[model samples]
Target: MAATACGTGSGPGGRADGRTERVTSLTALDYYTDTTEHAHWGELLTGCGEKAGVAVEHRSVPAPSLVPTALRQASAGTLPDLLMLDNPDLQQFARSGVLAPLRAYGVRTDGFGAGILSAGTYRGEVYGLAPTVNTLALFYDKRALAEAGVPVPRTWDELRKAARATTRPGRYGLAVDADASFEATFQFLPFLWSNGGDERRLDDPRAVEALGLWTGLVRDGSVSRSVLTWNQADVHEQFLGGRAAMMVNGPWRIPALDAAEDLDWGVVPLPVPRAGDALVTPLGGEVWTVPRNDSEARRRKAAEVLACLNGPASMLALADWHHTVPSRPDVAGRY
Candidate 1:
């Protein structure tokens, strides 16, 4: 956890007798509100806290409320000693000057993938780190594909044909989170990036081509217009109910899909624009940070716990439990 070198010394108070007092407890907050998920995280934090010689008080809030709650706490000068933020929101909080730089606390910042490291960095300083991360993939119903005589797709042309072939009276060939929210953008990036479309230049021909593929599918009845209102969970529900033969989703859905005894499913990396083009998927995960607080001792203790959470053993355990990829390349290779 990197704390072995830092050493746990005096916490908040010093005695005239010269005996160092250790911090015995710390507070942590995150958005793992689902019962089982929350419990798993609670166990991990407790274990890490034990290694750091402290007890951790772990709490969770709804995902959408996390940022707002954190901001309010920061304003009140009461942010949790250890905090978790969605990767995309880390920059905003770091820029707000409420997160302490991880390096400053002696937390190891190397050995992570470049994209994930960038996600945690603000103004050239790394402020957060995630044990595991995830990205999108194409999940298809094996029975449906077999019935349609379509093989798993590897290119845009194959995907379009497969989708069209799999469409039936009660089921759309493909489903995706296409609601007017960031979920839609998250699902759309692979197509846009793989097609050589730049978000900075939506007017590019490649961007138009990417949009046309999605629109074309809906027009051809291979994708439902209702996708305009569906979020990721809704798309997963549609797939589970057999109303969609294939869906664009992430590995986090694997547990639910595995629980459907009658369903036979397969997943593959998202199809690219061409056979040789690289598929570019958006990175997704939550990062843990030590929020700036009044007590240096408390912050240091929190950093020790943070380091423990990001340690190799913890990363592998998290990746296995959550069906995610480890953030460190070496850990990911082993995973």
Candidate 2:
């Protein structure tokens, strides 16, 4: 996506005397609460803000608190000038009239995957864009799998057998986020989708089969009951601590996995129900948006910063740093 000033209208930095005015500062928010992740994003935002001729005030909240905080800010008429939302949550806020369409600020929306573009679009308008995106995959410990004499699984049957073979006293064969949160739903989607289960028809036999797979794993002692309370982060920690031989997680966990000196891990696309079945994973990432606010100038500046953040250089840098795929295909190709 490419964004540039759209018109000569007297907007931010525009003057009545046909001169230019500059917005000096802006506020931005997101859910990057980890110390390293937060600092990385802050640096990117600050750089983008400088390019937009503004200083940015960056803030972060815990993942679960981000939406509620944004809601409170929206209700109080104090939404941050630039807001970052998980793609799944974009529609709710867009429908609530809290986001401005990227088109209104001249953001070129071509060259993106249909799924991600749809994720950022609401009512046929683009409200946000992500620099990079991610999806779930099966991560396994090489040593554990080798010890169990099982190759990486490619289908449900193989996965089940491998899980059973790897099982022992203190370790689980697999781990997944199954808490009563979006993370659980996110983790389950690949199974549901790959099995031909539709969200609209949860009672379908295929959906039932998908759910059965999860329950069967728990009942057979391949997966732990503690999965009921685990989030993705917790699941990753379980894998890192050697309590889990395999995990269903996204690439965001790569940094931590690579940092563990004794760990030798490998990843594969999520297994499918059958050998030829397509594995469908949910799209995962955060989108940057210019929120509706009091000052058009501020909104414009925010848009500028948003544009900078989504530019090719920034996209590649973010993907390299975070182990995510660049959202734009051209950039991803280069990456």
Candidate 3:
């Protein structure tokens, strides 16, 4: 099994004075440039920081700028006391030894979903955990599909058929990001994983089949060629403008979707390759980490804030605020 490690220790954080250091403030870094997202995080960080007996100096950057910022911080030996990395980048950061292994700080990882754990693990140890995680889903205009007498699709065949039936004079039936970027890969993974396409074997016929499914949608005019240039935000805009009836997106778009002009949207699991096949979508979220610091007490205090931020109630609150599912399945029930 490709499982993330969950063990306990209290060894690493920072090397501080032998005496416990008093931390007045801790630096926190995240990529939550969206006004609502940034504010929500600020409120949560304040509450958690208070509980940890430290004030938080929170800073946010655009999502695209986060990795570069972290890289610069790492090189300068000035990584924030706390870091929030999109899951894919967590392991690499952890592997570089700049991140303090979360378990060492008495943080629990007992009930996070496998995918989230997988993304935050390096070698056999977990270095981070998210408060809320998201995954791709099939989002349809409920009214449009209902008006067209089409139900939600459950398999590749049904998805193709629904897309075909919904295609109209000014609108495409479906849309996705087909650009050559990680966003495209993110949007493609559900189809690939659902069809049993292993990332380790790109030569596998299942992988080709999954690719064919997406290309076939475009070839058949069910999807626009614009997908080649569009990203998820573009796709979301298209869906909101009624230029696409269905999209492969996630709940992170829900806040915007809710604010749109009277669009009734419904979400379902991404379509499977075949009926009865389990839907397997890529996990999307940011994981919190405590960086290696010079002060052990400060590092430990930062870990306290990290833990406080991910407590059950905090998880639910953030998940609700972000329109995402809580990282811990047990805590998700309350949201």
Candidate 4:
């Protein structure tokens, strides 16, 4: 269904206690912290609402800052009929009873990616829906590596060697975001994983090792000290402009990288530090949910909206439109 297929405004009159009340009005807070996400969400929500017979309103809030406000609002009985949140934030809110359990409403996680599904689950209850996927991985310029006589690094030590070998007077070896935004966590995660560390236990020896590995790059001149001021855009610019040879980024940059006329780049999973060390980075994505309310008709309408958002045809359409992996693995290739 399309936007034109759905009727606009409250039917007959704008009464809050009549048949119009049964027509659910859902609001979605965009968890994506970028302008591109805003545009994509506008399209997706519009199409989904048109198809599902619901009215959707959306607001933008930074991912890190939306949790407390959403929770406070939910507790005050002013909860949005729908919410967009991150996996970690969703889990936290679900555990605190701010989000209603989706199991009773026929929401299922079995259709989503395994990693995304795990992120949405807290104990045995599933409280959120992941409709997009993203993660940080190592990105390298193939030509730079070959010209510099360096191989794509598969381990931390090798990575250091490659960085050292790739550096020149005008170009840096490696670059990463070190700013205060959520992007900093992306820059840090690969290092943490390579050293067997995590944010939950910062005092761990492995954690220190991870931090040291990152600081060591600066000390050894493999990474610039100015990274402390870099954000994701800065790091991206450095790579694209040939001022940096290696960095960590996600699939979202694939289009830009592909369009670069002079750069030759490829992506690989995050590398390890020790011989046996395994690398797993933090995951980031959006979770869409229907809020708790008193009307069964409204709840059903919300369910229909979610179905349209999660449906096979709609998911594939959205994935293609937004350059993202659809929530269902089966339809990912369509993107």
Which one wins on TM-score? 2
Write the number of the candidate with greater lDDT, choosing between 1 and 3: 1
Instruction: Give me the runs in candidate 1 sitting further than 4 Å from their true place.
Output: 1-22
- Please provide TM-scores, in order, for all candidate models, with all chains considered together: 0.88, 0.92, 0.86, 0.81
lDDT of 2 by residue, 1-335 (tens): 11122222223565557656657777888888777778778878877876777777888888888899999999999998999999999999999998999989887788887888888999999999988999999999999999999999999999998888888988999999999988899999999999999988999999999999899999999999999999998999999999999999988888889999999999999899999998888889999999998667777878888998999989988888889998889889999
For 1-335, candidate 4 gives per-residue lDDT tens digits of 11212334431223446655447356666555566656666677777776665567767776556777787787887777677776667776777776666777676567778777777777887767777677787789898889989889988888889899998887888888887766788678778866767789999999998887778888988888888988776888889999899987777677678889998898887778866767777776777776776655555566666766677776776566545677788878666
lDDT of 1 by residue, 29-108 (tens): 89887666787788888788877877788889876688899999999999998999989899899999999999998999
Q: Model 3: per-residue lDDT, tens digit, 100-155?
A: 98888788888887877777788988888888887888899988788778789989
Clashing pairs in 2: 13-21
Q: What are the runs in model 4 whose C-alpha is more than 4 Å off?
A: 1-25, 68-72, 75-78, 113-115, 198-200, 275-277, 293-299, 317-329, 332-335
TM-score of candidate 4 against the unseen true structure: 0.81
- Ordered from best to worst lDDT, the candidate numbers read 1, 2, 3, 4
Say which prediction, candidate 1 or candidate 4, comes out ahead on TM-score.
1
Better of 3 and 4 by TM-score: 3
In candidate 2 the C-alpha lDDT for residue 285 amounts to 92
